[model samples]
Target: MSRAAGLSRRQFLALGWFPWLRPRHIGLAGARFRILRNGRSLRRYLRIHGNEETARQVLERHMETHEGIAFVIESRTRVVAVESLQLDPNRMFSRVGAEANLKLLNPGVAPERVRRALDLLDRGREKLVRALTPPRGGMTIALHNNSSAYSVTAEVPISDQTSLREPGNPHAFFLCTDPRDFETLKTSPYNVVLQQHGPKQDDGSLSRLAAARAFRYVNLEVAAGQTERQREMLNWLEWFLP
Candidate 1:
């Protein structure tokens, strides 16, 4: 498959056959996430989207036994209420993305309120990013759960390289932000995509921050409900990424 990992061509069908598959930080000032530290390691884990129940479950279980710090948002829904405004935690990492999301989510919000909200987010973003960012030589791994509507096909266009291993499970895949990490991950028996280059427009996603900062970032996006498969993929990533 060009310079990509050797993956057989599939119909790129909407992910259908995948095995199906944590924290309380109470705050409204800005995006809040509770910390789950299981031993100490350079490796860091994340579950930013609160509505992604599958990811939350996987991260909660993984942290109980894994050696890394896990950060999970406190909410049970996708959009979090901050300053009486709905904001996507994942999009609060950068100013541009945060501003766009803030406006889109709260269209009726006053102009002054929007400015104040962004300021609050900016302050909170700094602290969270500091704790979330992995150290040099460490890995920042994120767990995300997606439905059939969101498949690897959505990412194929922007991905630098891909390895589609599971013939029936198109939703189970790994996305990494470093080339060297991709090289190691591609050798695995699962699907993986290498996206080392940062996009021109930042989405305020963790992967974008990782690419900009030149750190190793890996995201395990599994079909919503496939905990077994997600865990397996996560374990595989930990085993080889380290």
Candidate 2:
């Protein structure tokens, strides 16, 4: 089998069966994220999109004292598996999502090249998924910063249940995949949604994969440049979710 970026054929084979290995770095198809392990059960990811600087800041601050594994993309601008492809990194978790993203990003690319890229993504996905998933069924929290136009309402139609704060704040909200976690988070000061059901369309997002695998997934989203808000949401999640 062909190798993913930074992963030897042996490492890829090993990762297929062993997800418990605690490495300080994880590899995607041809990309990598620098990982910080703090001996905590919570797993976190930041900057899957290159422009989410606020989310990166929140993870950076969270790393100072917390014990858990955190993965931050090495770059500030490219959010796709391969920078040249411009495919959204967050959308490359599944074959369907990968193909859709590749088409959307490189509409003019040759069919052969797209097939090869998709093959690489399929091979690398298992290892990366295991790496992102916590061993003891811990929660995986992803931080994001969005523009004002995106809000909880956009996600409510697809969600199974929702906890919207009175006079809701569209600039911030939480998207969770596990029902129990959603129930607990609904009482928080932030907006919360339970997306346990698979949506009619798969965007190939990390949350979709997490839900497919029945993992507890939480996405902390706030307005762009809202570093403090993102940080507070992360802190609250660390305290509230198990």
Candidate 3:
């Protein structure tokens, strides 16, 4: 019952042969995570970066009582696939991002190996992206935690719409990808930004892809361990966005 190293790739593949082992329970992308679907259109992701425990706690608690699907990465670090590669899971959504991630993670990597990895990820990325996207009109919410250094100012340069509260804690804010959502969130007490329009450069994060598809994506970012604050914003979103 321990969550740590629950099953090896070989064991997982062996178990998949049994009819009882459903896809929801089975891991994806080398057994990185399991998707829990609760008869709701809402989709959520946590622990994309292993150290974001505050985000993980908030989402986990929210999922327990709400009807939705949540993908919980089973790693304590940012790098999920090929740990040695040091790639960020959030950057695996787009082709350009994936290429950059592989290169960044594996500096001086052989071109042949990089190409091979991209070929493999391209296939897996399609499945993961589909799984991440919610049912029609549903929202994909990703929770993240930031340290002191990361703040709203850094995002302001690329933000198409922004509502920064005077003296508001920059470490805690929201990054949304829909204009209407931004309009609504701007009225709220927290800081919010709209990136509905793509910035000149694309880092290949989920937000960019979601924006491209016109999906309603909300990212709740807060200082690490600010569970109460994060939960409040999440609850506010359910009422405001719905």
TM-score per prediction, in order, is: 0.84, 0.85, 0.85
Task: Report the lDDT tens digits of candidate 1 across residue range 1-242.
Answer: 34223433452222212312022343335556777766668988888888889899889988888887778877788888777888888887788887888899998889888888888887767667888889878988999999879877777778889888775777888889999988998898888888888458888777888888888899999888899989998888878777
In model 3, the runs with Cα more than 4 Å from the true position are 1-22, 25-31, 42-47
lDDT comparison, 2 vs 3, better candidate: 2
- 74-167 per-residue lDDT for model 3 (tens digits): 7787676642355677877776887798898888988777777667667777777787786787788888888888888788889998999734
Whose lDDT is higher: candidate 1's or candidate 2's?
1
Candidates sorted by lDDT, best first: 1, 2, 3
Instruction: Locate the minimum summed-lDDT window of 10 residues in model 2.
Output: 16-25
Q: State which candidate has the highest lDDT.
A: 1
Give model 3's clash tally: 0
lDDT of 1: 0.80
